[model samples]
Target: MNSCPFQRARSPEQKAERRAQILEAAALFFAEQRFAAISLAAIARQSGVTKAALYRYFPSKEALFLALYLSELDAMVEAPLPQEGPAWAAISELLIARPLFCRLTSILHTVLEHNLDESQAREFKQALLACFAQLAARLQRDFALEGDQAIRFLMQVQQSVIGCWAVSQPAPVVASVIKAPPLDVFQVEFGDALRTQLRALQAAL
Candidate 1:
């Protein structure tokens, strides 16, 4: 008898490996294209999985990207920021180094959260809160902030990243236009603007 060709992940470890492979494929697509431009069929092809198999791992495109974003958040929480004389510099540098994370975060509210079902939404938010709480605790310890202050600081930083990233990444034509002498003033340098905003927020708090 001819052997069946499709491979199935029966063990938990195999399932996790399959999930990671899918996430990796999604990440590559995200790096090269805008969020709105990516599709499940493309991702399925890249990951060597049928669209049906992809749905078994993730209910929707939103759910899959949300899972990837959550993994990024977990990595950020685990990464160490400098606990030196000033916190803003370290934080700014960290964000600058992670452009994909910043981009995903920029769309967290506007896109990724919209199509999610209740269970998916709850799971994402709960994981998000856990990441936030851990990061806030570190901020409080490093910056001598009260609990509320730390939370507020993070909220402000989130807003700053979202706003700054959006402005810095204009449409292709607009991006070219902005590089001209007269329009150069409108161009926003993500790292510089973010550092300035973070420094101001730290000073205010």
Candidate 2:
């Protein structure tokens, strides 16, 4: 028999709220900490739920991370994108507003994207593809681009964001250098880099 922790969920809304609470806690932790360094127990504590109850919402830490990523995508989907200089501007604005989201992208390929079973990985990949596809389709409308062009544009956007994130998020010493005079010129802003790439792509196309 399953044991309920704290209190049993009496309604579907309660269940959903509980799940959202866990996800919110996890996302806040990920924003402030490294992906590999965060633990499910920590998330349970932060969410004010028992470890057993946290497991009821997310089977593992990676699953929780996946949920966080999905929430990020949902935010992007909800935004009303205007056509004028929108792609880069919109994405850059998003990264600026949620810098932790950019950090997650930097780790996605190397860390959080791995260490999963085939089935789970497939599920995550499908959701990722869907997000990319939706973004690309919207780009098609905005740029009046072909299907392939839309996808390629999105790929470039991801690469720019990831690369800029890596460059901008340096160690203590490097970060200091990046923020100082002279060296500050070398600081890479993800938003600017993304906008530059889009402009270049527009010129090329």
Candidate 3:
């Protein structure tokens, strides 16, 4: 006699739990290996799912990466600004304290340098500009910065930070150094730089 076996379909909660597990595993794998080099099979193996099952959750590696990218962005934007500081110091602290900060920067650099298609690259650029725009809006509301000048100042600060990250050798070392400088040091130097340039623009306005 032959016996018949039945498998139960997972509930929505169970499916979501499995997807989270896969994402967590993928995040670890991506952190350990280069994003461009890692295969979906490797992610599946690490995630303890078959490739087909992984596909059901994430159609492609790019999709999975995009999900991860957005997650990192959410974390960065949601992090609390420092309660008391000059504007630049507060901004630096917010950037540095995010759990995904270094990885987020690394991923952005990686995407810009390779892997992204033209459309995807355009979308990424838009998202970056949008983030800066939001930051500028927040600054204007909180600190009373004026008009387009405020937005341009925010953009300059963002560009300066990205430029530093891009050319810096030994990425981790540079990330650490930027975070460790004294409050006064950053406020007097970087803050003055932003304020002077922005105030000049504000004066013209």
Strongest candidate by lDDT: 1
TM-score of 1: 0.93
Pick by TM-score: which candidate is best?
1
Q: Candidate 2 vs candidate 3: which has greater TM-score?
A: 2
Prediction 3 global C-alpha lDDT: 0.60
lDDT score at residue 190, model 3, on the 0-100 scale: 34
The C-alpha RMSD of each candidate to the native structure, in angstroms, is 3.3, 3.7, 8.3
Residue by residue across 92-133, what tens digits does model 3's lDDT show? 556545434444454555463356578766876677677767
Spell out the clash pairs found in candidate 3: none
Candidate 2 deviation (Cα RMSD): 3.7
Worst 10 residues of 2 by lDDT: 1-10
lDDT of 1 by residue, 161-186 (tens): 99999988888899998898998999
**Model 2: clashing residue pairs?**
none
TM-score of each: 0.93, 0.85, 0.59
User: What clash count does candidate 2 reach?
Assistant: 0
Question: lDDT, candidate 3, residue 84?
Answer: 64
